[model samples]
Target: MWYLISYVEEALKYIEANYSEAVTIQDLANWLGLERTYLYRLFNSMVGMSPQAYLLDVRIRQACTLLTHSDLTITNIARSVGYEDSLYFSRLFRRKKGQTPSQYRLTHQSPESNS
Candidate 1:
């Protein structure tokens, strides 16, 4: 119980630290010194999603922040968040956020900004 919690915490930290890179469940399990199947089951049981889903969520969340706060091009932003294909990134972003990344940035821009 508590052991699983500790593993989950460590896994989350690793995910956050390496979300910009290409991370996989096997990598995470290897880092934690656990079997991939066990880690996947434990993570899914606790986090309510697969490790891949969690990774995507983290990447998308970071993309949202970069989209709103930085002037980086969408392609660059996508790459920065571990996505190699900007079009796939945009499609995933729209599916998750209900709007294109550009639209999200436009709507979320600061009220005082004139851009």
Candidate 2:
């Protein structure tokens, strides 16, 4: 169990480091030194999904925080979160957030925005 915890921690760190790049399951599995199938099992066992899902969730969560707090443009937000194409980023954000990125930002202004 501890080994798995360490594995998850390492994997998460790698994701954070490389989330800006074009990451794939095979690449992430290789980076973590785990067989793809076993990695999938371990990730699913611990997090209820594969690493890809976790990475996307992390990105979306980060985007949500950025949206509420920052004045960056939508495309900039998308790029900051590893998306080169705002269209795809917007689609992904909407899929996860039920609103476009702009709408999310507009609706979720933070204290900074008030100032």
Candidate 3:
């Protein structure tokens, strides 16, 4: 169990570091030397979400950071977060954050960034 937990942790770290790249469950399993299905099960059990879900979460969270802290354009920010389709990214961002990225930045941007 602990060993599985460690694998999940490593998977989480990989996701965090590579969130701006197109990563897949198969890639994670290959990196961990585990079967793809097994990695999915273990990740779901350990993290309460599938690897894909977790990846999206990380991407959106990173997008949120970029939105709040930078003056990058929306399309650039979308690509920066590993979303090649700005429209899809905006739709997903709306689903996760209850607003478009622009709205989020408007509401959450730091005072210094507001200048």
Highest-scoring model, TM-score: 3
List model 3 lDDT by residue over 1-115, tens digit each. 7898899999999999998887787888999999999999999988999999999999999999999888999999999989889999999999999999999999999877656
* Model 1 agreement with the true structure over 1-115: per-residue lDDT tens digits: 7999999999999999999987788999999999999989999999999888999999999998888778888999999999899999999999999999999989886644345
Total residue pair clashes for candidate 1: 0
What is the lDDT of every predicted structure here? 0.91, 0.87, 0.92
What does candidate 2's lDDT look like per residue over 1-115, in tens digits?
A: 8999888878889888878777887898888888989888888888788899989998898889889988888889889888999999999999998999989888898887655
Q: Which regions in candidate 2 have their CA more than 4 angstroms from the true location?
A: none
Reference-based lDDT, residue 114, model 2:
51
Query: Which wins on TM-score, candidate 1 or candidate 3?
Result: 3
Clashing pairs in 3: none
- Rate residue 15 of model 1 by lDDT: 95
Of 1 and 2, the candidate ranking higher by TM-score: 1
- Off by more than 4 A, model 3: none
Worst 10 residues of 3 by lDDT: 106-115
For candidate 2, list the clashing residue pairs, or say none: none
